[model samples]
Target chain A: MSETPIAAPDPPPGLSELFLAFASMSLAGFGGVLPWARRAVVEQRKWLTAEQFNEAFSFSQLLPGPNIVNFSVIFGSRLRGPAGAAVALAGLLGPPLVIVTIFAMLYTRYGDIPWLQGVLSGLAAAAAGLIIATTAKMAKPLFEKALATRSLDAAPLVALAVFFAIGILRWPLPYVLAVAAPVSIALAWFRR
Target chain B: MKGDGDILLTLAGHFALLSLFAIGGANAAVPEMHRVAVELRHWMTDRQFADLFAIAQVSPGPNVIIVTLIGYQAAGLAGALVATLAMCGPTCVFAFYMGRTWERFREARWRNAIQSGLVPISIGLIAASALILALAADRNWVAGAVTFATAAFGYWTRLNPLWMFTAAGLIGLAGYI
Candidate 1:
């Protein structure tokens, strides 16, 4: 790819705005933020274009931290410069700390009740749908790329198969992952 | 609880394992976390795991906040602290130290291969987790409908899913399902 200059992201509304936006999304995110993140950053705020999001998202996935954190870095760096990364990271983590502490307390007390069970069961299931929809939409273009590339790539297929076996089949997932994870790492190491 | 020691050990184990596998985000390694925490250790049930995850999402910190909670629940304050440190400690050190070097290798073929591989596997694992939740969560027609419809509706349509989440919650609240 030829080097093309990146036009700087328009200055954000402010650091506070960036903080609030990230915090709001973090607090509201129930299952995961793949959907909400895309919605907020891409569509709602128009902070980044559809194409820009696609590129950033790949990096977000590849980097070590949570994709959302990686996103905050890129998004924040774009908006606020170096300091922006700090603001975004802080905002992303602040709310969840308090919320999870309280939640942990409550969970210990009333976790096994019938109604709560029903509620969470429903939520978890819906969460599944959310993941499916999110992954499908996220990967729709990638899948198309696979077809265009005219190759049945082993990576996604193996990961998918392992997940099905472990998560769906309820196989001892650790065993499966232990086997596969290292192999993939080694494959990358050798291929490198 | 059996004691603090057991909890600390569990926390240590989870931290080590999740750190190694938690490449993308806490969620990326969740299916694996579920395996170790819920299945192998039986430290928490699937529903418990899901419940913790809910707590995790609603928290103010990273997705890994659940690790702290899980640790706390498993052991106590010490557990929580240990779990938090274990999970974040290694990753943070590595991320910082290798930051420049890793960035330099960003465009390398092996990097590309690993990433390309992670994508499909992540999708599959995520799908499998979703399917598993479907089995556990869908108990009745309305519940099942909510699950499937929410997915299809969210996917095919451009409607925000939170609205559907509320709609489903109301259905449950009404005692209809």
Candidate 2:
């Protein structure tokens, strides 16, 4: 796995750029923001390679709290330390907070209208689709790796167990993780 | 009724605790949040909570901002501020420190295993999130069709999804769903 390191072609983005980029993505992110985050960081800005983006995002998910919020903080910290983390977090949060509040105010006033309800219902369904798409995109790389190796790995099996426990049985997260996390990690450790 | 300050303090405390437990992100904590806000504290009715959930999902930014909406419902603007900070603050700091450590040990063997091991679990949880959202949002067959079509389009194409969202909303506005 060792390869000679090469310098990045472009310099890392500055703090302000980080802020603006996060802010723009946050606003543009309807339904879910992770896909937008991946798009901006990996495809558009080239801040991180696709693999790096997946690792960072996976780390964020492993940690407590919201995955994207943690992702923003971690990414900012990686590039520019604490202040960068602060700015990215602020950027990710500030604009949407204001806009959502405005929507909240409006909701209280016209919440009962059929048209508004209808629009929201449609949007919600589409939002679900967006997440499904995101899940598929995330899974593709793992499946590809499994196929290339043609080795039986714990990944797909563990993933199925998790989906069944949480999605179908609706188990509380902590209990399911108590079993799945350890078993998965052990399987990975031995295999590695 | 509890005093305003008491309510704010309570919201802050509860969300702060929830923040640490929200593994796999905010959607993972939806059931807990529902129990706390609607059943325990009685801040809002079930209908209001469901409406706010819809609003949060439809808005921009992280879906976790549902905390902001819940806070606004219970208190006001200040409530929104308090709840959001409470939910994000500790986790942000934790991520800050953890990110540094993770980078420092990027080449470590165990770290790589941990990283690879966690990916599938994260994917599974996200799939669950998608399934739950589909169940909740797709009340009618038209809406379900929209969900299916949107997923297929999003998966196969690289187009900006905002267009689909706009079209879906318009369909709703037109009384189709």
In order, the first chain's TM-score in every candidate is 0.64, 0.70
Which segments of model 2 are wrong by more than 4 Å?
A1-18, A30-62, A78-81, A140-153, B1-10, B27-54
Per-residue lDDT tens digits for candidate 2, residues A133-161, read 97898889877788899987679878878
Which runs in model 1 stand beyond 4 Å of their true positions? Answer: A1-25, A28-57, A70-90, A112-114, A142-156, A168-192, B55-62, B76-78
DockQ of 2: 0.58
Best candidate, DockQ-wise? 2
Q: Please give the lDDT score at residue B36 for candidate 1.
A: 68
Please provide, for model 1 over B1-177, each residue's C-alpha lDDT reduced to its tens digit, 9 standing for 90 to 100: 556687697678777656655654776566666666776777777667766664564444556677778776777668777877677655544443443244446578777776755665566656666666566566677777877887887789987656766666666656655
The window of 10 residues in a row where model 1 chain B has the poorest summed lDDT is B92-101
B53: Cα error in model 2, Å: 4.5
lDDT of each: 0.65, 0.81
